[model samples]
Target: MELLKKDNYYHIYNREINSETVFQDANNMSYFLKLVEKYLIPKVNILAYCLLNNHFHFAIEVTADTKDVNQAFSNLFNAYTKAYNKQNSRTGALFERPFKKKTG
Candidate 1:
């Protein structure tokens, strides 16, 4: 994982493990965004976002020089994964190993 630089834009993305559906229903999408707002909104400014069945993407700009940027993302995914696992009655990794990012 790369350290997110302040004032830089990035294209961030991740996919569900084994191409399984990450969002089972509309409520799952809402819950995922709520988690994003809780954990990532303070760390980055979201420029755009798209959520599909098995993956999601985000265009964002880092707003500050904070060491917790990566941790915020980890927290966001972990929280969502936990809720998703519990709700779906499944276990193990929910997403791919490391989320991907690119300068944009």
Candidate 2:
């Protein structure tokens, strides 16, 4: 589990279970990016990121008086899941966990 305190940076990674292709093509990846910009970038600081077929990596920072990182993550994940499910006609969890966050 990740404990997000104030003024800290974390290395975060999330993977699709069973190594399924969460992002099948460039268009899917683009859609995910659109959702991130629409919902995530405005809320938190995303220092670095790399998106792959079944997972992604992120280096991010949180404010000192932060309240909920989970909510922010959920918005992005749920939005992507909804879009992916609608596009691919599938239903299930997109990520394996609550997103691993290591503070540094």
Candidate 3:
């Protein structure tokens, strides 16, 4: 996991474990976005985003650039995964790994 730098733009992404569907329905997508808004919006300025069946992408600019940024991402995924697992009656990891990021 790379630490986000202040004022830096980045492309961040993640995929579902085993190439499985992450957003099974419209409600799932909405919930995931809500989690993003809650946890990521404060840390980065979102430029663009795409949420597919098994993966998600984000174009963003770092805002605060604190170490807590990673924790925010972790919280976002953890919360979403927990909700998804409970809703779908499944358990274990949701994402393939910690999200990957690149300068863009």
RMSD values, in order shown: 1.0, 1.7, 1.0
Could you say which candidate leads in TM-score? Answer: 1
Tell me the tens digit of each residue's lDDT in model 1 across 1-104: 66888888999999998898999889999999999999999999999999999999999999867588888988999999999999989998899979999998
When sorted by lDDT, best at the front, the candidate numbers are: 1, 3, 2
Q: Report how far residue 89 has shifted in candidate 3, in Å.
A: 1.2
**Candidate 2 least-lDDT 10 residues:** 63-72
User: In lDDT terms, which candidate is top?
Assistant: 1
lDDT tens digits by residue: candidate 2, 80-100: 988888898888877877678
Better of 1 and 3 by lDDT: 1
lDDT of 2: 0.80
Model 1 weakest 10-residue run by lDDT: 64-73
Question: Model 2, which residues run further than 4 Å from truth?
Answer: none
In candidate 3, what are the lDDT values of residues 22-100, reduced to their tens digit? Answer: 9998889999999999999998899999999999999999888567777788899999999999998999999978688
Off-target runs (Cα >4 Å) in candidate 1 are none
* Rank by TM-score (best first): 1, 3, 2
